[model samples]
Target: SYKPNIAFYEAHGLKGWQALEKTIAYLNEKCPDHFTIADAKRGDIGNTSSRYAKAFFEELNFDSITVAPYMGKDSIEPFLEYENKHTILLALTSNVGAFDYQTKMIGDQMLYQKVIDISKEWKNSRNLMYVIGATKAEYLADVRKIIPDSFLLVPGVGAQGGSLEKVCEFGMNDQVGLLVNSSRGILYASNGRDFAEAAAKKARELHVQMKKILINY
Candidate 1:
């Protein structure tokens, strides 16, 4: 799967958007079997969210998109309305600032737990996936108790100090439900003419490690 975080493209204005569109188009045409995530972290009021949903799922034709769950069910429903698409909610992020709220105990459950638990009751909740950072792999077991069957997008491996072994150990469901994205490490794998080859080398390294882990499972 290729996750192109729109922020990286949007920083360049119109050309950035065009680049993103062309990128997605190329992927859809050449790598149709691969999943594409519009890592836009969007969630707003109902009407506004509908447009956002269309912009990614229809306009850009992404299979999935990351979203912020801070706005509650109504804000998320617009995205969920899509039949075959996925709405990946922000659960426990890999960032340092996550401790500010996500892990806080709230009436016997953490805030992220509350978000996950409540989300299950929403319309089309079956389409909901989640973001569980690799850096927070220790907490993944507890998260699994709530959404064991749901797919998780696990970032923070490589440059972010997250151990792939730890993430796979605690977060893997029977379906092998994890998408470990290693953008920075792969992108900057080399700063010379061998850059593309180096990035592929890094990705193959992760793939080999993952295959080894799954073999024991």
Candidate 2:
């Protein structure tokens, strides 16, 4: 799976948009079998959400998109309407700022748990997934309890100091429903002439570790 966070591209202005388009096109041409995620973290009102859904799933042709669930079901339902596409909701993110609201206790359960529990009742939730940070890998056990079979997109593996072994131990389901992402760790592996080679080497290391973890599962 390849997840290109839109922010990285958008930061470069027009060239960023061009690069993003070309990247997606290249992925489609070279590896159509691989899942592509647009890490946009978008969530808006019904009308605007519909357009965002069309832009990513229809126009951009990404297999899935990361969406913020703060606006409630009305904002997210538009994305869920797409049968073949996936809507990955932000739950426990891999950033320091997540401590602000996501972890606050709402009675016996944390806020993120409430988001997961309530989202489970949303229509067409079978196509739903959650973003749980690898930085908080220990919480995976608790997250699995809310939605045992749902897929989880875990970022913060490399540059963010997340442990893949810890994530796999508690986050992996019978279906192996976890996508551990390493962006800067792989992208910026080298700034010299051998950047691509260095990136490949970094990716291979993660792949090897993942394979080892999968063996135990």
Candidate 3:
């Protein structure tokens, strides 16, 4: 969260995304223990997405990434080719506009549910995961039922009005398969050089909260 995940930089422009690569490299070198993610919501034709996979996994060497699943299974398979690296497919997103398509009822199931169901069909699907936004807290149980063992990269905790407790209640598994991210809340905690330290403090706070939650279970 402290490090603007790749998509934040990508949102700026191509140069910004390149800068994001450099930033991940610097973070890996400077803070070896930190987790780095390329938040690129990429999912396209096979060859195209494969190239995107090469860029992120081989060239940039990000630990994880966010991907879109609109293009279907073929668009996602190439990303899973990279061993140990993770591909987080967008399911339920934090944005208000997510309701435009995700919530539309379909045969008594939401559209996002169908995405999760289809996503389970890909090779190495265990390495693949879903971005189940904390905003749609109520749907966590349904998503969990579809893929109980798969990891979920959750966002919208702090600034987006998502409840940590509720998400954990419905989604937590034996291995704690949830990464609840708080980007803006942690990053913009301060604007000065102390920003990093402030961000770390916020992360620590969330960590404490997470620890307590884990303890209860």
Candidates arranged by lDDT, highest first: 2, 1, 3
Clash tally, candidates in order: 0, 0, 0
lDDT of each: 0.95, 0.96, 0.85
Best lDDT among the predictions, by candidate number: 2
For candidate 3, report its TM-score.
0.90
Stretches of candidate 3 exceeding 4 Å from the true structure: 1-3, 7-18, 31-33
Q: Put down candidate 2 lDDT per residue, 73-138, tens digits, no spaces.
A: 999999999998999999999999999999999999999999999999999999999999999999
Candidate 3 lDDT over 101-168, as tens digits, reads 98888897899998888888889887788899998888899998898998888899987889999999
TM-score list, all predictions: 0.98, 0.97, 0.90
Report lDDT (Cα) of residue 202, candidate 3: 91
lDDT tens per residue, model 1, 1-217: 9999899999999999999999999999999999999999999999999999999999999999999999999999999999999999999999998999999998989999999999999999999999998999999999999999999999999899899999988999999989998889898899999999999999999989988998999
